[model samples]
Target chain A: MSILDLGKACTFSQMQLEITYKGEPAPAAKVWRRVKWQKEKVDEFKTDEEGRVELPEIMERSVMQLLPSEFVVSQAIVVTYMDEEYKIWVNSKRSPEKNSELDGSDIHLKCELTDERRLVSDYESDFLTSCEII
Target chain B: MTALDPLNAAELADDIYQVEDEFTREIFYEKYKDRFELGKDSGLSDTGIKGKTGGILLKYPHMMAVMIEGKKKTSFDGQAVFAVKGTAGLMDALTDLNAGIKNARTGGKVHQGFLDVFDSYAGKLPTLSSNIHTIHCVGHSLGGALATLTADWLKSTSGKEVKLYTFGSPRVGLEHYASKAQRSIGAGNIYRVYHKTDPVPMVPTWPFFHIPDGGEGDFLLPSGLHLKPWEFHSMKRYIKSSKGDGSQSLEWSTLRSRRPQDFLDSSVEAWLKSNSIVSFTLNSARLLSAAILWVVKKLTNLLGISVVIAGSTTFTLLDRLAMLMSKGLELAKDVSIWVTRLIKRMAQMLGIVVREGAEMTMRFIRQVFIQAHHAVSELVRQAGRTLH
Candidate 1:
C-alpha cells in the first residue's frame, strides 16, 4: 500500500480493492482518488495484473478542517479503461475514525465495471458506488 | 412573452460555475457564444477573500457572474441574463453563517450575508440598453439568494421587467420581505425550484421565509434516496430534473409538488406516539421543526407574550424558542406531554435515547436544540466545502 501525503491535514483509512471488467481482471487500469473538499489534489494509482489495487491512506493537511466545522470528507474514486472513465466510488465520510468508511469493518471491496452504481445510506456515511464490501 | 422558463435558467445557473476558473472561463464563453453576447465587462465583481477582514480589503472581481445579452432566436431575446455561482470557498461559507437579519433596500428585512454580497456585485453589472425588456436573475444555492435579492432590487429600481429563477436556495427574508417581493416581482414571474430533500432551502429557520409567499410558482422535485443535503442540493440534480428526457423539458403540469402545510396538533402528537423512527431525511427534520415552531407559537399566543427577540437579552432564537416550550410544559399537562414527545423524537433522530420518566427541564430541551443545531451546521458545512 502507498501513502500519499497530500498536504498537512488528516489522513484517511486505507482500503483494499479489486477491479474487474467484463468478468475479467482489469490490469493496469488507471485509478484516480480525490477528496472533493481539497481543491486540485488528486492522487492516481494503477491496478496490478491480478486486477488488484491497494488504495493507500490519503493524508491531507487542511487548516479548514482544524476549525470547529463538520468533518465531512467528500471522497471520490474513478477508474479509466480503454479511454473511458467509470465512477467506482463516491462517498461523503462523516467521521475521522479509522475504517469509518466501512463501518469499522475491514476495508476490502470488489468492484465490477459492469455493475450499476447504487446508493448505500448508513448512520455515519452516505455513498454511491458500483463496489461491494467483501 | 417573458413567461417563466425554468429549464433554460437552470442550465445557465449550472453553467456559471465553469467560469470561476481562468481556463474554464474561455470554454464557457465559447460554448455560449451562439446564444449570448459576452464581453470582458460582463463579469460581475464581488469582494473575494484576501485575508484578515474577510474580503473587506480585497475588493476585486471574481468570476461569480456572467452578464450576457440573448440573441434574437433565443427565448431570452431582448433580455439580459445574469447567472451567479454558488458557494465556492471557506469565505463564502462564512458569509452563509452570517444569518442575522438586516433592513433590505428592496423593502423588508433580509439576510445580512446575502445582501452584503449582492450589494458588492450589483454595481459592477454593465448598463443595459434601452432595447432590453427584462432581466433574468438566475443562480443555485447561495447564488439563489443573490438572485432573489437582485430580482427584488431590479424590480424596484430598473424600470425594466424583472424575472427571478433559483434552485435549492435558503430562505432570504422575513414575512414582510416575502410579501413585498411577491407583490413587486409578480408571483408568476419568480420560479423558485428546490428538491424535497435539499436541506439548504430549509435553513436559517423561522423568521426567514422564501419569496413568492407560501411557495407559490415554485417547483419542488422529488428526490431519490440521496437524502444527504449536498447530494440533493447539487445543480446537476436540478438540471436533470428540469430536463425530463434527453429531448423534452419536464412538464410543469405533471411535476406539481405537494405543498406541506403546517402540521396540525393532532398530526404532530400522532407521529410522535406512532414510535416511527425519525430518520435523517429533510422531511422528517422539517416536520419536527414545524411542530416545535407550532408549539412555540401556540404557547406565545396563549400567554399573550410577544415572540419578538429583545436585542438587550443574551438569548438566541433557539434559546428563546426552547424557553417558551419549557414554560408551556409547566402551565399545561398537554403541553408537558407534547414537549416530552417532541424531545424524544428529536433524540431518536440524533441517535440519542431519552430515559423514561426523566425530568424535561429547560436545560434538557436546550441541550437537545444544541445537538440538533450541531447536526444541521455539520451538514451545511459539508455542503459548503464542495469548493471546486
Candidate 2:
C-alpha cells in the first residue's frame, strides 16, 4: 500500500477530557463531540466528580468519497456547564499516530460564569464556533 | 493580589539602602512617620547583635515590615554581590556563592547564609509573634537577598501572608528553596524589580537561581540606549525607572513566564563572557604600554647613562612605541564598537522575530542560533587577533 493508503487505515485513540472552572474541577458537565458541517453527534460523555471524562476510542477515517478528495473529517467537542459552552476542535490529520491513548492535559475546558444565567444563545454558539478552533 | 501596598513596598526598599546613620534614620522616619511607625534596627554580628548586617523594622496598623540595608558603600556592595568565593563574611554574599541548600527549622532546606541571617534577627523581630495581616520584606542587592529569607522565615513561622520586594537581588537559593518559598508566601506576594542590564541579578551564576513569586518587573532601557551594569544596579536608577508609580509594571501574574530560569541561567554565562572580553580589550593595551615605559626607564637608570642621554633616548624609544600602541588601541576600540553594533543588530533581529510571531518556530529559532554563534565567534576571533 502507498503511504497515503497506510495513513488512511483505521486507527483508534482515547481522549481524556477535563473541565475546570477557575482552576477547580467542574463536575457533571454535559459534553459531546460532533461533526461541524453535518451537525451529526458522534458521542456524548459527562465529567465525574473530579471534572474528568474518558471518551471511548475514536477512529480516524478518510471521508474522500463522501465529500471532496482533499476534504478530511474532523471532530469538535462541545461542553456545556452553568450557562457557558466551551468548544474544542480535533483535527484528524494532527492526531497522534504513535500513541493509542492521548492524555488531554492540553484539552482542559475552562468554563466562565455568564453575566446572566439562561440557555445557550444561538449568537453565542455561532460566536464560539467562529472563534479560534481550540 | 498582595495585601501589601506596592508604594509602601518601594518606599521601604529605597529607604533601607540609604546610609543608616542616626541622622539618615531620623530623616527616613520623618518622611514616613505618618504612615508607618519606625522600630529598632537589627544589627548583624556572629552573635547577631552588634554589626551592620541586619535590617530595620517598620510597623503599620495592618502590616509589619522588615527593611534590610544593602552594603554601606556602593563599591563594597558591587564587589560583594559578584564575588565567587563562598567564604565571604557577608551573609548574602556567602549564600549567593554557596552551591546547595541546608535544612531549616520549618522543615525545608534553604540557603545557609540566608537562614543564618534570618536566625540572627528572627528572635528580635516583633512581627514574628504579631497578628499582622501582612509582613513586608524589602531590600536592595545583598539586602534584597536577606529580604527574601526574611519573608520565607516569617511565612513558615507565623503563617502570616508575607510580601517580598527586592531591588536588583542576587540569587538567593536553589530550586527547592524557591519552590518552598513560593508555596509559603503565595506567588503573588513577591515583587522583584531588576533593570535589564543589572549584573547583580545575574549571579551567583547558575545552579543558583531566583524565581520571583509575584513576577519580575524588568526595566529595559529605551531603544538604542545602554547603561553601564553598575548604573543599572543603582537604587537611584531603579527609582527613576519606576517614575514613582508603585504598582507592578505589567499584569502578567505568572512568575518566570517571559524570562524563564533557563533563559536567565544561560544569560549569566553570556553576560560574563561579554564583560570579560570588553574589560580585557579596553585595559590590556594601555597596561602593556605603561609596563614597557616603566621597564625602559628602569633600564636606563640601571645602565648609569648620563642623565641627558638617558632622558633623550628613553623619550625617543617611548614615543615610537607609544605611537604604535595608540594605533593598536584605536583598532581595539573600533573592534569593540563593531562588536557592540553586532549585538544591537542581533537584539533587533530577535525583537523582529518576536514581533512577527515566529519566536516559537523551530526554523526561526535555529536561524537565530546560527546568527548568534557566527557573531560570537567573529568577536572571539577579533579579540584573539588583538591579543596576538
Candidate 3:
C-alpha cells in the first residue's frame, strides 16, 4: 500500500450558478453532482425562474480522495434539460485553487443551441460539449 | 401625383438614379419612356464640363425639371461633401456644405461651379429653358448633397418653389444654412429620408448640421440582427428597409429557450470536419480506450477488488502481464479525461477573449468620438478668440 498527499481540501461556503440559453434564463432545469466511485447523486436541485441555482457548500474530502499521483478523481455538475445532460466537470486540484474564495466563485454558463431535437448530433457534441463554462 | 409628394419624389429619384447603370441612352429612354422623356445627359466630355461629371435631366409633362446625378468618380461624392472647403473644383460641394441659414433665407452667394452649370443649361440649351416649371432635385449619398445645392440654386435663380428630396444625404451646411433652407423651401417641400445606421447623416461632425427643411423620414431596422456598419450605409439596404414591414425581414432572434447546446455542437462538428483524418482517428481511439477503461473500472469495483496486480510477481507470468495491462488502461483513461477537459477550457477562454476584444473596440471608438468632439470645439473657440 502507498500513501499519497492530495493537497489541501477547500470548501465552497456559498456560490450561485446561473445558466442561460442565449440571453434568457433557463428555468426548472435539474442540476446534480454524482459521487466518483458509486455514481450516487450527492447533491441535487432545480434552477429558479431566473436560471439561478444556489450550490450547497462542497467539502473537498467528500468529493475527492487520495489515489496514486498519476490517477485523478473528477467531479462533475450535471444539468439536465429536455432529457439531455450537460456536464461541467470540476477539477479537484484546480477548482479549489482558482475558485476556493467566495469572491469569484459564482459560475455563469451560457449555452448556445442550434437544433433542439439533435442536440448531440455528430460534430456538435465534440465542439459544443463545453459551450461556455465560466 | 405632384412631385412635391415625399414618397413619390423618393421613388422617382431612385428611378432616375438607376439611369446611370445603362450602357446607352437608348436603353434608358426605352425603360423610362412611360413616366419621363429624357431631356439631356449633362456633364458629358463634349458638353464642356471639365470633370467626368454626369447628371441626367428628365422631363415630365406635369414636372418640367428633375435632375439626378452623383459625383463623377466616387459614385456619390461623399468624400467631396466632407471636405468643407470652397475651392473652385469643389465649389458646389463646399457651397452646399456651408449653405447656412443666412445663405438659405437671403439667397446669399452661390457656388460659381453650380452657377456655371445652371447657366450653361438654362442659357445655351433652349430645350432646357431659362426657368424650370417645377424643379425637383434628387440624389443618394454624395449625389444627395449635390442635389441639395442644385435645389437651392434653382430656388434662388428661377424664384420657383423647388422641391428637394435626398436619400442618405450628409449635412449640407452650418446651423444657419439649415435654418434658412428650412424657412425658404417651406419645410414641407424638402424630404430627407435616412436609415438609422447610415454613417452619411453623421458626418462633418460638429457645428455642421443636416438640412432642417422637411421633417426627416427615418428607416429603422429591427433589433438583434447584426449588420456591418457599411451594410447599414448601403443604398440597397436603405431601399429594403424602406419597403419592408419588419415582420418578414431577415433578423436574428434573441430567444434561446430550447436546447442551447446545438450551436456548440455544430461548431465542434465543423472543427472536426476541418481536421486531418489521422488526428480524428487518434482522438476516436483515445475516446474508445477511455470508455473501455471506465467499463473495466466499474466491473473491478463491483467485484470488490481494491487493486489489480501486474508485472513481475510470484503468480503466473501471464496473470501478472494481464494485471499490468489493466493498470495501463486505467492511467490512459485518466489522461484522456484530463486532455479533454484541457481542450474544453482552452476553447472557453478563446471565446471569452474574442467577445471581450470586440466590446473593447466599441468602447474605444466611443471614447475617440468624444475626444474628437472636444478637440474640435476647443479649436473653434480658439479661432473665435483670435478673431475677437
- Give the winner by lDDT: 1
Per-residue C-alpha lDDT of model 2 across residues A1-134, encoded as one tens digit per residue: 33554434223334565666666777998887664211233678888998888765443343322211111123455678886776543332212232211222222233432322122112101112212212
Using lDDT as the measure, what is the rank order of every candidate, best first? 1, 2, 3
The local lDDT score (0 to 100) that residue B89 gets in candidate 1 is 35
Q: Mark the regions of model 2 whose C-alpha exceeds 4 Å error after superposition.
A: A1-134, B1-7, B39-101, B128-131, B213-224, B244-388
Say which prediction, candidate 1 or candidate 2, comes out ahead on lDDT: 1
Residue B139's lDDT within candidate 1 is 84
Q: Write the per-residue lDDT of candidate 1 for residues B96-156, one digit (tens) a residue.
A: 4334566789767776767777777777667777888888989887778878888888788
Model 2 residue B96 CA deviation (Å) reads: 8.1
Q: What digit string (tens of lDDT, one per residue) describes model 3 on residues B21-78?
A: 1111222233333334233542112211111222221111111123322233432221
Question: What pairs collide in candidate 1?
Answer: A7-A61, A8-A61, A9-A60, A9-A61, A9-A62
Please, what are the lDDT tens digits per residue for candidate 2 over residues B1-388? 2333333444455554222221122333434333433344312111111113321211111111233222333221211110001111342233222233456655545555556655655566543223234556667665677677767776777665666767767667654566677777776666787654444554443224574522343322321154233345545455545443443433323223434222232343244234233322212322222233232233333443221222233332213322333333334553333323333333443343244322223334334434433333333233222210
Give the Å shift of residue A98 in candidate 3.
Answer: 51
Q: Is candidate 2 or 3 superior in TM-score? A: 2
Which CAPRI quality tier does the interface of model 1 achieve? incorrect
For candidate 1, give the lDDT: 0.67
**In terms of DockQ, which candidate is stronger, 1 or 3?**
1
Choose the strongest candidate by DockQ: 1
